[model samples]
Target: MDKEQVKKLRAICRDISVLYVEDDISISAQLEKLLRKIFNNVEVEKNGLSGVQSYTKNRQDIVITDISMPVMDGIEMCKRIKLINSEQNILVTSAHNDAEYLVKLIDIGVDKFITKPIDMGSFLSNISKIAISIYREKRETVLESRIKAQQNLQKELLNGIIFPLAYFDEGEIVYANSSFKKQFFTEIDAGDFSRFRLGYLFENKKYVSMSNSELVQEISNSDDKTYLVMDVNKKIVKKYSISVTKFQNAKGCLLSFVNLNALNEEINRFSEQVDYFPKRESFSQALLEPKKSTKENYEIFCVGLKNTKGFIDKYGGAKMHSIFNSLAKSLKKEFSAEVQSKELSIYLFETNRYIFLVEKNLDNSAIDKRLSDFGKKYNYAFGSGLPLELSFIKENIKNTQSIGDILENTEGMLYTLSTI
Candidate 1:
């Protein structure tokens, strides 16, 4: 090879890794040093068996092996590697120049063979050709992997969007967001929709003016106008106006759907406010009422909701209501024995969090014990998901410190415990 050829091959080998297997200790050591100088990574094995084991554990880009070794010969090793990856790049070295053996090596998918008294010029030139091939193949592999990664990132971003969204390629659906999946094809794969046009989804439902081919062409052009389509979700049909945007570097477009009626219904739900959480507000307020016995200090302990929206999204409103109601009822019953009904309050704090307040007449130790007991009795499974960021901290509500200040400090403590 010329100086330029050698430099080019070395540059390619600089990023490639190699695995060398041989029984000759002196030969193996010499080749190891040579391979290390050229390739980015070099792994050496004394025998064929360990070589196979090493390759299985950590695959390299190129493999070079001797024809004979102890425990397992190179023939069997080559066969095993070929079975694993038929396209594996391999070079074999042997002293014998037998025709039958050379034919066998070719059959086992060996790329090149070097004689025992190797000619340095021939070795460098042939190996350079293999390196060039490997470099080109690696670029293709890297390109494909990056494309897949980009697609995965796009899917994640689409899922974060609040409304139903889908992507089409050649007028066939290839990707759908989580909202679209839940609303329509929860059990079906996005690829299954690829065989049919987007208009196929509208059959047996709301009538639209455009034909499948016409709609597909219109969407490809994406004039920034909304088109009415049937949101065929399970057996129910909801009228959704879809906006299309042509995607750069793609032969298709992104479709976003908005159901005006559904949005209005959601708005109505948020508008209606609860005057009180049935009896919860009164219970918390009753604790602030003056006690007939003595003027006493108060101790507050709290459990908070981390992501209120996320919790409701995962567990639903019914489960949220049921668990909060149950937890409040349990806390009241547990602490009522030691403290007066008027002194114990399970208050509904910010964003549906619960704060337990009790007058300091009872032992603080007793309150801590009950809280710890409930946490353990549930095997911490109560918090596998739910409230009880309750690492019950004692915050004093003195003359100067407001109840809000006390609860805020406790909320901070609970947040730390939840993270830990």
Candidate 2:
């Protein structure tokens, strides 16, 4: 072999340990030197019995042995090794070219064979091949271990998520998280998830009317955004927000659900309060009053209570109404002067919705940051141990459009944010 070939062969064999059994002292000495040069560890045994003992103490990557030995022949030792580990790689060296002996070695699962008065060239070549196979096997084992670890981490992350979630492969339900199983399959036997389809969870006929293929096609062809509302039948109907996203390769998709029935009921109560409040006409008049200059800029904000019904249910509507009135009073106290100065105006649309018209010259980003911070502060201070979150959607009012157009665009933006 060329020097470069020898160098590469040694590099491949460097990490491997070898066990060699030979009764002849001269041959054993020569082979042991060569093996020590190529491998990190070399073990020599004068008999097959000693060889098997050495291997049992510390297994080697490769085993080479002569069939003719004084104690416990190579065949018998190899048979015992095979019983311990069927995948052990063994190389047999023998002086006899007897067909039966060679056949027996092969039956015992010897990896390679070399005849007596071994050819150095063939021996080196076989060693190189075996070394390469060992390296590949080690790599495959490491890769498999890494893959298993990643799978375990993914499973843990999925289980830790709070939302009910499911994964679909093409049209079939491949997996569901613990939350999903508990929420949707409580009465059904576990592992019977295969009986359910993704469409069966939705309330509207829109999803149920389409086949799985059709649904997949629709989701794939569209903007890839999720559907917002889902209905579930328990003792009573419940509403949830559903979010779906396709896998990167387009082979699968994941769905998650967030129950929003409490929030919906709160909004419904706010709608009912509309009949009791008579501030609509005054708020409209205030908003419709002409500005100082037609060239002046302004920003419009549409705000609504998030999950207000849940808050009211937990802390009665009378208390929630008082909180809302207090919030409105606070806003008026802070901004009524600005409204008089043509810099800002706050209008109440319904019990839950408010429109803020502010001077357009204000930095949009700064306003957003301020409002977000203010929302957090207000919720913490006056939320009565409930979240009492709020949603604020904004748009620029560039023209002297009618109140109808302004309200329409504001509601459109709110709807968009709700879906998101």
Candidate 3:
């Protein structure tokens, strides 16, 4: 390997703890010095017996052993270690170059090998590769454990509550409580939610069946952010009192639901608390109806964020909201202060989507320059350095009476201006 790669690998080795077993005093002493320089902790054992004992106590990140030893051989020690932890990472150094003996070590699940009379360079490179692999595997194990803990906590909270609830993350359903899951999903679709569809809840009857995106869009657009779904299982059509929460900490909203037959105080209490999703009806109305006295036309800029999942994963949900709010405020400031003879009205269509309306007097070139400038300034908004991309689509309603005509005549759908 190159020097740069070896240097990087050596950095990774700082986190790794090692157990080295060698019968020869000279070899063990030399190797231990080199290993101690890179590895955080190095435990040296004279023979396989002591190695096994030390491993039982420490369970180090890596185990390096000599094949031939006094009390027990490296193969035997590996077999016992495998019994203790099946996923243990073991590297064997062997002078004996027999194919059958190597096959035996492979069968015992030895991860790597360095032949006798070790080239110090090759040895360091191999150990570095194994070190990185072990590090990544352990990191994944920790991440999965954290995710499970969060899910368990959510499940406990959801199960205790009487109401059935499902939550969304950026217009996509991430989780639903047990009550919601049991009521909605079938036995076949229990563990695997890849084929999860809201339409499956009521197959035969259809009131207003929409995709996750469509549902979220409706919630964002309407003043009454509640969806009244019917429980078709009962003889009497039971109406559900639904409300989308204004929980600001999260990127998505909590969908609170209760039966209409429940106490008036409970429904009203929920409505009072979570009813903060304001209706963005002005833009939609502007699309259809024109101001008769002025007869003004608007230039439409349809904007969206690209690869939002990766952005959210890196920066988190609250940061994602800050990004959107920051963009909205910047656009508002630009239109209100700088741009002359132009009025701007912006509507947050979805979590990562926006509709911008500016006076149609300015041509596409002017809008492009303004958007490009705004994008450049926004890139350096915070010292945190957010890699935010704004996908803009330009369509003018200059001579055309309606926005529909602009949509019909538009060539391109969207253009991503900024990049990470």
Highest lDDT: which candidate?
Answer: 2
Q: State residue 117's C-alpha deviation in candidate 3, in Å.
A: 2.0
Could you estimate the TM-score for every candidate? Answer: 0.58, 0.58, 0.48
- The 10-residue segment with the lowest total lDDT in model 3: 411-420
- Residue-pair clashes per candidate: 0, 1, 0
On the 0 to 100 scale, the lDDT of residue 378 in model 1 is 37
lDDT of each: 0.68, 0.74, 0.69
* Tens-digit lDDT track of model 1 for 246-316: 76777877777887667776565334323222234554455455651235667767654334455568767
RMSD of each: 9.4, 13.1, 19.3
Off by over 4 Å in 3: 1-10, 154-163, 167-175, 178-239, 243-255, 258-263, 266-420
Query: Alpha carbon lDDT of residue 408, candidate 3?
Result: 46
- Candidate 3: give the clashing pairs: none
Write down the TM-score for model 1: 0.58
Write the residue-wise lDDT of candidate 2 on 1-420 in tens digits. 988988888888877889999999988888888788789888999888999999999898899999889979999999988887889989888889899998888888885899979888888888888989999888899999999999989978998986788787766677778777766663552557566655655555687777665665665566643454333324344566665677676787887777676666567656644433335466556556666236665787776667677777887776777677656655566555665785666667656677776776656677577667767766522636667666788887767666787667766865765443
Model 1 pairs in collision: none
